[model samples]
Target: MKRALTDLAVFGGPAAFLRPLLVGMPTVGDRARFLARLEWALDNEWLTNGGPLATELEGRIADITGVRYCVATCNATAALQLVLRASGVTGQVIMPSLTFAATPHSASWIGLEPVFCDVDPVTGCLDPARVAELITPATGAIVGVHLWGRAAPVTELEKLAAEHGVKLFFDAAHAFGCTSGDRPIGGFGNAEVFSFHATKTVMSFEGGAVTTDDGELAEQLVALRSFGIDRNKSVTAVGMNAKMSECSAAMGLTSLDAFGETRERNRENHALYRSELSGVPGIEVLPFDESERNNHQYVILLTDHAVTGLHRDRLQTLLQAEKVFPQLYFSPPCHLMPAYRTDPPLRLEHTERLSERVLALPTGPSVSFEDIRRVSSIIRLAAERGEQIDAMWAGAVPA
Candidate 1:
């Protein structure tokens, strides 16, 4: 533990950790099983194009998500694009600005304008009231993001979409294996997309899937993921190459097999963080719902600079100096990015405020309980001496 500001690595003292603790370290499970599946794929010489392994993965995901059809893709962005294309929605899509850039990118890439909306201050998900306000005759769809494994306002978004005669879908990238009430996340909206990227709780060695109950839409998606070729070997529609390989599917299967254990470890880590940072003033470890099934993928913290006397960025720098690398997720948010920036400048009060305060700490299978404790100790110490640290930081900065 750091005794004084000078004892910190930033002050030329030894780092608390020799190696950097990272957020979103890949969770590799049962290596032997993954290898065996990989070997099978090799022996069969079936690498891609909806091979048997990919088919099995789709089935398993469908079963888990409680959706009728699961169309696996090369990545989540492609899955989103495919779903948007298949839905035939046009003009503009309303989405929270507090999401990964891919959410807006997917829509914009397919010729639809992405209108940024503010999120709910508490949940950090798309505000249904804001969505209602954004609806217009040209509003093609409403895309809700399940931020940090928490479900979006699904019921309300659904109602709004239905009332407005617009389509609805979710970017369930952070919400794989999560639930809202008893229903799984992937089963919500017209269709939902799950990201199995290396950073996610469940991974397919870089893959994603779109889950939906609409048979015709599913059929269209299946064809679209390929070269728009149908079962009859006829070109049905314009499409892109977005099929998940057998190797990725094998990894996906292994990830699913270990999901239970991973979820448990993540849950334990979250609990430990909450306990370790319990009474730290102006420091809040975001809470997950106990009633709903959650992947517990993120260990997020919200810092109140006024109360803590240290800004979130300064706290982040202090932690990083100790070799703990937390992420400022969705900072500069999608709306603020150069590609999406409006001429007049868009102001999303909630998103802007939350983006400055939110920080994602290290968790997942890679992080241990002891690591959480140490990280929390650094935070507690910093908060305890926040003013001093702030003064030190300010002095260190070159005028």
Candidate 2:
């Protein structure tokens, strides 16, 4: 609908929509069911410290993920930290820089040094070849992240980890209800951590879980989450208070009940985006494997400045002015963040390049089909008029 520069909201014209279309909006399940569960938790008066609801949630997660054991935590960070510690790994941990800061932060917080690795440019997941190149006697473990709800190079990473004799795990924050081949994500490696944060498709308001088939490791995690107190109620090992509350578990159950419906909606939105953006120069919608089960929670885009004549940041700004807000998921990647920056500075070519180009558009239950159409139209308009917009930006002074 926007015909020219003068018609764009960024150029002093009216916005395309009355309200902002935002990315990562929380998906609310059946309101009545959620309220009933909340009321039950309150009536029971068991809020935290491994209550009935928390225990039930853990069992459900284990069942859903096809893992023998599941330990729910206050958040994914805590789950990661606990899993890394309980896996009995020491020294350096290798992980991709193209991820949320929490991935490395968890390792670093537990006194392990995080070694940054580059990712596969197309998949946006850890490159096993890079991991092989980085492995040393000092490397304690290898962590792979499932980006955009797509499975990481699980088979290859498993092979590398086995050959090197190091522990392997996954940061499956974006991969709940997703699959790696015939298997579920949580069953991979020594363990996998999933986030149930509100933003996730299957949310618990604010919670996370660690899944594993290792009984001993599961016991250790159980003890670790509750300050290392064993059945006899005596301190055994150094631990942190990272238990999920009953309220969060109740919400989690409700969310799980609505998973199928939410996933369908997400799938529809993703399909609409792909169809609408097809053949639009310089804009690519990331694809998920059709054969495997996926949550389809994120609608990712890769902007090619060379073709579009506008970089990803400028395109994002243009969209935002029209009251459509997309997200730069991991622009300043983990290795580039202040807390995790390397001494001599690391140069991960693929990681750096992908970080700059990747953008997450609005999707999920909150976004309607019409919303996707409007957002897609805005992108198409920007791409079509990229040269003129680039020139206008070049001539304009910095604000």
Candidate 3:
């Protein structure tokens, strides 16, 4: 009988393999739970917008997010578009260049010019003070990205937006379960859009939502998602078929119940990685406050610049060879993407550098603390060996 060489594979005795494609927690609901809701939808035959599960899910989400109203949509991008349109954003909208392109793309899709702004290197969030500097007479609104499940300083941005007399819309795709002070990450501004993509803290299989307190805007969003239906099919304004189907909503209903435990697991795994990877040479592991962050993705900054004879991309390849696949979540800053190529409002040096260095380990629900430990150890080993970890771009794919 042949003996196995190593205890790294999931089937090979180790609980974690080198590059286990974790079942990401950003899940909406369990199979049986969501399937049960699906059965409900099937029973009622209310299979479209405002169905039982959809309404129920939206209510639960609003309760979770501390918002007065929630509008579930086909996807996060549509939620963003609806909010931007409903808010009357025209001309320029200020946004961070370090985030996913969804923020700016939603603006552009709705005919608003996205004026790129800078981010805070420490927090990887749009700096409110820089937001002030980026505002112009043409600037219509501020789109704040709560990227990587870390809540931005929304309070500061709120003050800045009010002072500038512009609206603040949060692209809160990564902000499920994230909170600030007494409120969760919704309804703090004119609107905040959430993504229930399979990769988010919460998932509805594939859906998104807009949370707001304004009834008029909420009304508009409802009308807007259903092809702008007015009395007798008289279209009031431009809208799209951005409705979340019953299947998605049913899944969401199930997701809400079990998501708390998944969230707890994520936090726990993150703490382990944070403790294990700290002070490691040539790498910068995170140290975010648990009270504030949702710890959606356990990321590190590869100080590949500090490591001689090594680049970022080669490290990824080597990790892949070892079956330990860590993600370079944002390999090229959003501004560097082909669709957004233009003269910048300012250079995004820090943003670009971060894109080259940031590495996201397996922090999903399927990934155990043991998984993080192994991944962290491999990263440290790679850094010690000075393997070239080259940079790679994840282009234009919206978060």
Q: Which model scores highest in lDDT?
A: 1
Error of 1 at 274 (Å): 0.2
Q: lDDT for model 3, please.
A: 0.75
lDDT per residue, candidate 3, 1-399, as tens digits? 322222223122443334554425466546887778788889999999678778888898888888789999999998999888877877899898887777788889878888877788777888888888888899899988886777888999999999989999898887887887767888778999998887766778899999988888898898898889854677888888999999988777776677787778777777787788777777776666656746355455455646534467755755555566677757677777888877653468667777787777667677767667766776676666553222112222222
Q: List per-prediction Cα lDDT, in the order shown.
A: 0.91, 0.91, 0.75
For candidate 1, write residues 1-399 as lDDT tens digits: 224444544434678536689999888799999999999999999999999999999999999999899999999999999999999999999999999999999999999999999999999999998888989999999999999999999999999988989999999999999999999889998999999999888899899999999999999999999989998889989989999999999999998898999999999999999999988899999999999999998999999999899999898888887889999977989888899888888999999999999999999888887789889988998888788788776564332
Candidate 3: how large is its RMSD? Answer: 6.4
**Order of the predicted models by lDDT, top scorer first:** 1, 2, 3
Cα RMSD for candidate 2?
Answer: 2.9
- Ranked candidates, highest TM-score first: 1, 2, 3
How does candidate 3 fare on TM-score? 0.88
RMSD of each: 2.8, 2.9, 6.4
Q: What TM-score would every model get versus the actual structure? A: 0.96, 0.95, 0.88
Best by TM-score: 1
